[model samples]
Target: MADDKKKKDDEVKKEESEGKKDADETTAASSKKKDDEPKKPDVPPVIAAGLRLERILTVSSPSGGSAPKAAAAGSPHSSDSATHNAAALTANVEAVLHSNPGKIVRRWLGTSSGTSSRATLADLSKGAEALLSHDGPCATGRELVMLLAPPTEGGGEAMDVDAKAGGEEKKDDDEKPKFLSTAAREYEAWLISLAVRLLWRDGRHGDAHSLAGKGVSILSAHMDDAARVTARAGAAGSLGKAGGASGLYPLLSRMHRYQSLAAEGLAGEQGESARAAMRADTAAAHRMACLRRDVDTQATLLNLMLRDLLNANQVEQAQKLLSNSTFPDSASNNQLCRYLYNSGRIQALRLEYTSAFSNLSQCLRKAPTNTGLGFRIAVQRLLVVVQLLMGEIPERNVFFTEGMVAELSPYLKITQAVRRGDLPFFKTTVAQCASRLREDGTYTLISRLAHSVVKAGLRRLNVSYSRISLDDVAHRLGLSCATSAEFVVAKAVRDGVIDATIDHAGGYVRSHDLVDVYATTEPAEAFHRRIAYCLTTHNDAVRGMRYPPDAYKRQLEASRGLKGKKDDDKTDEEKAQEFEEEMDEDY
Candidate 1:
């Protein structure tokens, strides 16, 4: 019985071991199956694409532990609302895309602030993929929307490729889709501009330049086509708004500016070819602007060309541009301010202090007070140097203005030295701030103030002493020798800077009594300038006022129509009643 029991127990143990091994194999197989299958990402492709386009590519990944996913998954209510909003956006995009070219332009232009809403942006982003097609104006519009997004982790090269339809490379330029409508072509131009900006931002200067050049060609072709159409139609089509060519002028100017910037960025590598391309583009754009009478665009390109010339140290070319081109009084205040600022810098470089001062002051006053802190600071810095060059001390409050103390500190030190007529201190300050001043493009102008400092010291000497020896004057003004001091004093006397006479034989300058108040034309000239500025301001204000077309003509016609009624058609009582009625109408 014992032997039979042992044999049965062995069989039972073997069976149990086999069963456990089978279970282990089953668990391993299940885990391997799970590993082999691909996992679905918590974030959707639509969301990812929008994020990539909207932000820097590198930062597109969610950082906060899948917070966005959790938020979507956590509430059914949120998901429903998101879906409804996306549906609405998809419908809106479809409606806009299907509309006529004129209506599309009007709707797009009317909603300038529409893109600022987060909810609307999110909804549109959700439907972006669905709305984008392989070809046509809608595709161009979609590309524009994508290009509007800033940047990310991926490089410009990849983003540039990805920006194309369906992320595929174009086989040939000739295969590009044709936009039939003017508004479509306008959106295409905008897309090109935005792409250029994106690539430029990504540090792909070569690509940006090439793309901008292509854009210019395309826009030129479009404009030519419109002109040809208008010509074919003759006088009747001239009143048809030239198929909205007015809108293209600004974009054309923008493209040219971008092209110049890109070429400038590649100047070191591409050499003169890049420079030639920039000049050609700018010149072409300028001619077009003038031809179109696009005052705004003309003003913009003028500033851009001036900036380029100034940066290249071609002051003469900049001056010529300023002289040759008239900045239209019809330009917006912002463009006007930029033109004035550039003009002031050029004039200061050309040793035209009075005109420079006038331009700079007008820029400062006309500049928008609510924004552009950096612009204000730059204008102020140049203005201070120009004032010092003109032998005038800048106000104390200028240096200490809020938000500009740090940037203006160097200028402040230079101003102090000039104000106190301390030539040694002035030279020291200039030396210390030389790099910054050069960076600011004012080193040359500031260097000219050494003479101003000397004149200021001479004026002080005339006020304090009846006579001062040239040797003493040289020592006091920190000049290298007495001869330079004598020459400076003689020039000051000749220029009527100080009431003094140079005695060459005695080697000294004699001080004369100060002239009486209001005895010269200085006050009258100053008053005249103030009055002229006021008149100019008033004139500009009047010119800038917007009125409906033929408004004056319509008013005059209505008044004349009222006056043309016959007076002999009524008796005395009726005439009196008619007179009373006319008086009431006038009132």
Candidate 2:
């Protein structure tokens, strides 16, 4: 019992020692923690106060404070990183615009592959068509024009098209910058054409005219440059492959339609004063379409203006359109033919029979047969009357062309009466066909044939008789008297149709001896021209040929087989003498 009590006392003492050791360890850990802990640094009072003021301003701005509001608006959304990236992108885009704007623009449209060029024209056409039907042209087309147009100072942002009239004033020469490339000119041309068409179709003729008539009138400047553009097709894109501005055709067709509507209002037989007033209005409309520098529009303007002039019998105005400079050969076949036809009619009205014959005949040959049969028929009808008026009998086949027999039958009677040299028959035929010809629009033209019929009768008389008195000729021609017959013969003689002299005192007309035309140098000129052309073609053929392969081969074989005999013979005096004698003999 005494030993157990001593052990417990030792255990209690050991427990007390353990507790004291634990307390000492905890105090050391607390000291280490205090040493390792971080302490706050002292702050400057002014900076701290200013920072607190900035926070207060950001959270709730003081009155009259603009800085915080601006900061709030200018700051990016919750995603500040996106806003930061966008700003960088905007800077990059601005850099590109300042450096290579065209390059960047082309990059967006993509490059042309083999098939892409074909699709390029198609895409452009589709986009143009779509724009025409949309309400967005004033929106998008205005933007496109600003993009394609010369860059201006201040880099004005494209505004709504309601301000387009204001933009028109912005087209200044000095401010114009070269922003478009040659490839882009096509886009410019297409835009201009589309704009004109839209303005035209919208019935804003005055605006269309004004827009097209601007000093930088799109058509007047670009059209004449077509030959140059097409000539440089290889340097430009594949524009030539797209037919070198086929967009002009449709645009021109619309212009033609516009002019046709103008002409139709004047087609009716209004009173003289009303007709004149309407014609003046039509002229003004066409004149507006005439831009100062555009050849195609100028020509078309001249053409439409001349049509009214010719119809009004204003020969002076017709002279301008009839001038050689009015029509360009670059125009379509139909336009040229119509121009030639109208000019011919003007010439005929002016009594220039030879010039009329030349122009009308050329027009008849070029008039598209299948597309506009009425126009072709009109041309043919004019040709018949003009041929008759020229005192020349048209051949039977002239009236019997393929697909034209029906249209020519009425004129066939006129042709026959002219050929037969029967004045009464001609008069009777004209009387019978007067209503039909009037509806065909050739009644006035055919009525003018009365003088020609008398001329034809006189021509036959000169062939049949050596001398005919004016009295007898008047009786045969169904004229009222010999005095009129004498005057008529005098006119025909001066006109060079009949080789005859009118003897007024003797009251007889004398025929000069007719020479055979085949004996003249006129045929020789044509033959010589043909011969020269043939010789030129032959020379070109000969110049293009290479050394004859078979002949060279034969010569080579002969040299190889001659065992040096050819060389020896060439050097030998006797062989050379023989060769010279043989050549001289042949010569």
Runs of candidate 2 with Cα error greater than 4 angstroms are 1-135, 138-253, 262-296, 436-445, 466-475, 481-587
Q: Positional deviation of 180 in candidate 2, in angstroms? A: 21
Q: After superposition, how far is residue 247 of candidate 1 from its true place, in Å?
A: 3.3
lDDT over C-alpha atoms for residue 144 of model 1: 45
lDDT of 2 at 356: 81
Q: List the residue pairs that clash in candidate 1.
A: 55-151, 56-151, 56-152, 57-151, 57-152, 57-153, 58-152, 58-153
**Cα-based TM-score, every candidate:** 0.66, 0.45
Q: Tell me model 1's lDDT, rounded to 2 decimals.
A: 0.67
Number of clashes recorded per candidate? 8, 1
Estimate, for each residue in 1-587, the C-alpha lDDT of model 1 and write its tens digit.
99999999999999999999999999999999999999974654333333323222112222322222332222223345445333322222222221123323333433422332222323333333332332432353455445445455658856765687573454564444221222334445655665676678778889888888878877776666455443444322231232324446656766877887788788565845787657766777778777766665687888888888888799999998888878876666788898899999999989999899989998999898878999999999999988888777889999999999999999999888877789999999899888998888888888888888888888888899998899999999999899989888889988888988888899998898888859989899889989988997898788778655556875786778743344445578787665544432221
Look at candidate 1 and tell me the lDDT of residue 23.
100
Write candidate 2's Cα lDDT for 476-562 as tens digits: 888889999888888888887688987778989999999797997869976985796578558746855645435676688697897
